[model samples]
Target: MRLILRNDLRKLMFALLLLAASFGHAGATPPPKEDQIILALIQRVEARTDLVFVRNGSDHNATEAAKHLRSKYKYFKVELIDAEDFIERCGSRSELTRKPYQVRTAGGAVRDAGDFLREELRALRAN
Candidate 1:
């Protein structure tokens, strides 16, 4: 009877191990590569305090721009297949007014936000 009980205990342990392994695989998966790139681009925006983000007709600081981009990313995540798609869809222009987004450097130079982010993305990929 003791030997039979030991065998049962081993079987139970094996079953538990299998259950744990299955759960590990079923747990939350990491974001896709493009999503990671998009997130990195947003981080870059947040880090660059020397730049001003212009959307529509208003200027925003880096933090505000990053926040807005995050909101847009969540809204357009399903449609984005790559970092470029994210730049074009969420970072490039105002959906409401069709106005292109702009970025102003500390030196007072202005450029399209999409182009800026594309350059950043290229740098990230190179690294």
Candidate 2:
């Protein structure tokens, strides 16, 4: 009986080890940076935008995200524009877009949803 119990315990331990190994890859949590959040939001545009950033100024959260993503993912094209530049291009506006991105949802605007966030980064991030 003792031998049987020991075997059962070993099996349980082995199962636990396998479970832990599977979960190990998920152990590393990403940092809570603004750029990371922006990237996460822009996740919707992944198929279209390898890296499309619509932020104002030389320094901003999107820039920071681009820098970080550059370190991690090499196969991306980072594009940056002034917040105003995006609003001019798109008429509709979200709080993120001080200019406006609130135009009729169609065609090129729909195609460039990732570019829609340029104003969002400005309102949300510094520089």
Candidate 3:
């Protein structure tokens, strides 16, 4: 009878531990809501461009910039907290090329990626 009681107590303790762990997990914060949206915006920017971007003071096409951003996402050094952070750290410049990115729009207007994305981010926030 004592052995059975001990076993039951052990099982009860295990169940309590599991319950506590589950509660802890439930209380943890979820990932930011803007990660996927920012990625899609990058793709949109890539698709909309028809001219060259100045990367490290040289011209690069939209495809190249998009590819570079994708690669950065693959091996991110830290967690991306939001869309703005992702744009500032990943999409606005090229770490590998050590340069700020500038896009030349289809109409031949050159704009810095940071400025362009800030406007885009504002639009997104509004909607």
State the displacement of the C-alpha of residue 13, model 2, in Å, after optimal TM-score superposition.
0.3
Per-residue lDDT over 1-127 for candidate 2, one digit per residue giving the tens place of the 0 to 100 score:
9999999999999999999988752433333363364454344223323333333322223344344334322221122233333233222222343532221132423223334455455545553
Name model 1 segments beyond 4 Å from true.
Answer: 1-31
Every candidate's CA RMSD: 10.1, 14.3, 8.3
Among these predictions, the greatest lDDT belongs to 1
C-alpha local distance difference test of each model: 0.89, 0.39, 0.72
Candidate whose TM-score is highest: 1
Number of clashes in model 3? 0
| Distance from true location, Cα of 120 in model 3, Å | 2.0
lDDT of 3 at 47: 77
lDDT of 3: 0.72
Higher-TM-score candidate among 2 and 3? 3
* lDDT per residue (tens digit) for residues 1-127 in model 1: 9999999999999999998977752433225876888899899999999999999889999999999999998887776667887888899999999999999999899999999999999998998
1 or 3: which has the higher lDDT? 1
Model 3 earns a TM-score of: 0.63
